[model samples]
Target: MRVEDSPLIDFIREEHRFSFGTFYFFDNFIISEINEGELFDWNKASEVIRVGQEFYGEEGQINYISNRIHDYAIKPQDWLRFLYERQLFKTFAVVTYRKTAIYNLVIERFFYKGDIFSFDSLLEAVNFIREQNALEPANDFDKLTQLYNDNSL
Candidate 1:
């Protein structure tokens, strides 16, 4: 299914312009897919935090999933700010197919203070979160996988 066609999109608020990527927000987590070659820094990070507050309210703690679908860079200095906003996230997950992205994740692990998990697919990421939070597993996992495979290229 196309992103526009996925029912999942209906529950997710999209914050795309400010961060130079597609950010999908659910009640408890945010999934961010970095735009190709985008430089994610303090300015964009601030917008993300602001948007998260708007979606989840000021006191809510959210999980985060980085869908590393494209190559990008994160400013190391901005990690300090991320540390401050660390309260906003209960856990962090990354899904990537690239070895280079895995290397980047290792570097990120040093700066981020939370449980971090890596997965090969979005479905696995979602399942991990569900398990962590004691939420029901997705009943249509196969359909979701097919939807992603069909539309994600």
Candidate 2:
């Protein structure tokens, strides 16, 4: 079912479909659901990040959630790209019921520096993000500068 048909419609502010996945953008975060058996490489990951930049611009500090409702795999090299570009997200959350996915997330967390959380369902992940977002300042100049490194000035 599309996000609009699902309960997420209320929480999602916008949605975009890419070549390999769909992005559900929320007020303070985004959820990406990759297509089944999709091969996520550095190029694809870059495209996704680019879309996020366009949607939120350089000033937004958004949390990210990967809703792994369908099976997919990322290229090994993409891990380095993800690690290097971790600043694209304030926190990373992965949702999956599959054991293998959970194991992979555990391994990924070892190399990821920022906060990473795993959940068995999308609702749980969104709830956690909402709670975290509530605690964060709406527009703290220092926090924004530190997170986004606003070098435009």
Candidate 3:
């Protein structure tokens, strides 16, 4: 379900709209809905990071959710730049049912330094984020792998 249709909207503490997309900031996570047909590259990613810091502060550890409600082109390789800049996230979740998005996610995994989770539903993604305990390391590789394997996302 789209974020707007989910109860998630009630939790959004701040919202930012750009030409490329909209960002919904919550207590523990931020949901991004990029515009259709837009190219999501490093330049656009910079804006996201800047605004996110404005809300959550630079030291905050918030999970990320790419709520892909519309078709868009993303530079999966830009993840390298994201990592190179030393930015980190507790978890990165993608909400998309498209086969192509899943395939692209596979490519993104190679560049992303942290684990990425995929879910067909927005609620599932939010639940997964909520389950994460931010005080501890989120490197429970086996458990995380099992969860994704079970979902086949």
Candidate 4:
């Protein structure tokens, strides 16, 4: 299928969302945006990312996507599945929102502190992913964080 055959996810709030811009899967080392605050489920997001990258015709899309951005509300179950499915986890700097402790509860309730990242954007939020910029209160995270943080505004 052609890139145009895919769907666009302009918004992913409380559930996963995917937006189809001109971004061909293979266009860059990174794949696409992973919005947080939208239902936090690893399998679901991974599946979406994989299907979206199907047109790119590359298998490394998972690794590329994983390396791209902050994970909003990932859980310990999600973490386990992520690790067991891929065997070894990607070295991407995955993160979740600090202000909302819902998913963080799941993370800490099940896994160790080192297994996940907790930040308020003022802490250690990444300044960029794939070299894209970020904004505050998540100023150090990806620009998508800017979007997620500003969605309600």
For candidate 3, write residues 25-115 as lDDT tens digits. Answer: 8767789999888989999989988888888888856689999888787786787878888656878999987877787778788888788
Instruction: Record all residue pairs in model 2 with backbone atoms less than 3 Å apart, i.e. clashing.
Output: none
Off by over 4 Å in 1: 1-7, 13-16, 139-153
**What digit string (tens of lDDT, one per residue) describes model 1 on residues 54-129?**
7778885788888888889888778867787556778788998789889888888888776679998776787677
Ten residues in sequence with the least summed lDDT for candidate 4: 1-10
Best model per TM-score: 3
Model 1 Cα shift for residue 142 (angstroms): 4.8
Q: Give the TM-score of each candidate.
A: 0.81, 0.77, 0.82, 0.37
Question: Could you tell which candidate, 1 or 3, scores higher by TM-score?
Answer: 3
The prediction achieving the highest lDDT against the true structure is 3
Q: In model 3, how large is the Cα lDDT of residue 84?
A: 83
What C-alpha lDDT values do all the predictions have?
0.73, 0.71, 0.76, 0.37
* lDDT-better candidate, 1 vs 3: 3
* Tens-digit per-residue lDDT, 15-80, candidate 4: 223541122233222333445444456756477556544644545422232221334445456766
**Model 2 TM-score (2 dp):** 0.77
Model 2 lDDT tens row, 83-139: 776666787889876887787677677666777898776656766775676533313
Q: What stretches of model 3 exceed 4 Å from their correct place?
A: 134-153
lDDT for position 58 in model 1 = 86
